[model samples]
Target: MSKLFSITLSLLLLFQSFNLDMIDVAQLDDFLIHAQFHKQKYGDNLFVFISKHYGELKTQHDLEHREEQKDHEELPFNHQTCSHFSAAFVLSGADFTIPKTPQLADTLSNFFYQESYCHMENSDIFQPPKVA
Candidate 1:
């Protein structure tokens, strides 16, 4: 992706997350109720109705954020280090042992020299079938 696209997408998601955090369903319900109240009281048109809804929403948000700013200002916090840093490490104690295996000279160790001797009586008995 291009750098500009990446930055724009990141910023869009960030601002959208903040917007989602600030707005709530209950707050929207309150806005709707107030809009209806204003419409009924003043018999305002669509323009006035939309204006009042967003106007109240922005005003309430501003007031809430202002209070938050004031609260943050009252805190006696600075960028100074508040606590000491601590670090710990342990030495690894690993022991490896390789077992020694005896190697065979040949893979076919099971096969050995066999005697090819056969009895003459056994060979005579192994004749072909004869016709009657």
Candidate 2:
């Protein structure tokens, strides 16, 4: 009976952990959606654009010895796009689907943290490169 109780307790703990992981994935999905919406409506504000375009800004500053004023180039949807305000406006309905759970992101982040020995990793191999 003690053995059975231990097994049941372990299973319950496992199930609770699994549920929490699912919640994290849901939160990540929500974050991606929020990013998409802000990009659509605000054209990537200061902070978001800073994070997204950090690479380019760094490179530009390195080459020119000056700070980059903006994060991204204006997309067709961002301004007057021939007949439309911007494509992001129309594309706003699309969902940002995360292929893996939030655990994946955390696991990957941790892996990179350990593997790179801190900032020794390449952004291109781990994350997306600058657009322009």
Candidate 3:
């Protein structure tokens, strides 16, 4: 196989391993509800990272729909958004404690951001574009 083909095949297999098809509307809804609970309990900054990324996902989806000549309706959540939200939820802890202070909230936000960043950095699908 050519080097480019080999690399593409490896990346495709790595992406398939993520099993994004397992995400469903029901699961996404549940995550949103839980996110709302966390937002209220832990304050807005607690989920700042997830919310920012969610907005980006929405924008991308809108652009995609526009390109396809379709009306843009808000999607509940896609695999990428679901995965990010799930990661943030777990990083924040399954057994939740409301962060009572700004410092605590900041700490949680930082943790979520760092974890998500590292995950993307390590993923073949998220690698930075190569320079010519």
Candidate 4:
């Protein structure tokens, strides 16, 4: 095989191994509900995707701490933001969906990059120059 093809095959195997602990269907349903809420509240400003439950907890906690420190004297937390579980959003539709595994991060990032480019009228970011 060519070097590029070998590299691609290696990456595919790595990703498959990484996604072993995929979120269950029920977890996905819950995540979808929460993601929908986030979308409605934050509009297009937020990125929706599945993340490791433990990984996001630390992040969520840090955000809370920052908010609390910002209001030093006040109680700070008036609402709950983090959930006990983790999930991935069904990007294309309700029926066809995949777990939000770490392996999908690169793909999701690329999709979002393209989407942002479209909104900014700069879709050329991913395009190649036309042949003469």
Candidate 5:
């Protein structure tokens, strides 16, 4: 009887965990919808541009963290890296054009930052960079 009870308890916990993951996924879907809207409002290839830059930022962050740990010192973080990287990517790509307006660029940057923050905050599963 004790063994049966243990098995049932384990199954219950597993099911609860699965339900929680589903809820997280649903929330992620909502974030994606907002991202899609911004992409369309600005330019079709905007998503791809932002995603590529975000990946580069994350990689840089990871490398900085490792270097800091190894050196036992904090490295100076570049505040303008995102803006500079985004500008370069936009200039390099000729297939699609991102709006040159400051407002549009700022809006796109904000969206990318927020989405990246949400993913890092809420999910344990690594989300692959999305291109649209």
Candidate 6:
């Protein structure tokens, strides 16, 4: 059961890290070709162009807007004909809490003994002779 759970979790993370739902193979190829041609398009000894208009998904994002920044969807979708994304995998699991062990007595002698009184002043509690 634990192994199955681990495998399931691993697959989930794998899909998320790769952005499986956001991928289109043909689009990726087109984006790469377009990126290669960016030098000719910009025409300015440009080592890099980090503008929001350069590289981005040309499709509208319906779900990537909930938790993520809306600017991802707000960027110009016509600048690039295909989706351009970066691969990222983040593994963070350093915050774990260790349970404390219970304190226990080493032996049965923890409590001294069950206190019992055999002697009585009137000696009528049992109404008979009592042995020490």
- lDDT tens digits, residue span 1-132, model 1: 699999999998986665443334335555556556656866876566564334455455346456444422322221133456899986678666699899868756777889977686567567877889
lDDT of 6 by residue, 14-130 (tens): 976765544443355544444455557645232342232243432232243343234333332323345689999866767666999999967766567677875866567758766
**Prediction 1 TM-score vs. true:** 0.26
Candidate 5 Cα errors over 4 Å, as ranges: 1-20, 44-54, 57-132
Q: Report the candidate with higher lDDT, 1 versus 4.
A: 1
After best superposition, candidate 5 residue 50: deviation in angstroms? 6.4
Q: Can you write out model 2's per-residue Cα lDDT over 1-132, one digit (the tens) per residue?
A: 999999999988987655444444445544455457657865876575444434355455336533322322221112222333544434668899869845444433433334436663654577766678
lDDT of 3: 0.52
Model 6 TM-score, all chains together: 0.26
Worst 10 residues of 3 by lDDT: 68-77
| TM-scores of the models, in the order given | 0.26, 0.20, 0.22, 0.24, 0.21, 0.26
Better of 3 and 4 by TM-score: 4
TM-score of 2: 0.20
Please list the Cα RMSD from the true structure of every candidate, rounded to 1 decimal place: 15.1, 37.9, 33.9, 33.1, 39.5, 16.9
**TM-score of candidate 3 on Cα atoms, chains taken together:** 0.22
Candidate 3 lDDT over 1-132, as tens digits, reads: 699999999987886666534344436665566456546765645356255336655465346446422211222344344334333333644667787855444443433333434555678787878989
Question: Residue-wise lDDT of candidate 5 within 1-132, one digit each (tens)?
Answer: 999999999987997655444444445554455446546764646455344234454465346456334321211121232223334334565568577855544443433333434556456466676789
Residues 13-120, model 4: lDDT tens digits = 986565422333235555555446545754522233222122354366446556434322222122234446878876665576577856544443433333433464
Once superposed on the true structure, which residue ranges of model 2 sit more than 4 Å away at CA? 1-20, 45-132
- Cα RMSD of predicted structure 5: 39.5
Question: lDDT of candidate 6 vs native?
Answer: 0.50
Worst 10 residues of 6 by lDDT: 44-53
Steric clash pairs (candidate 6): none
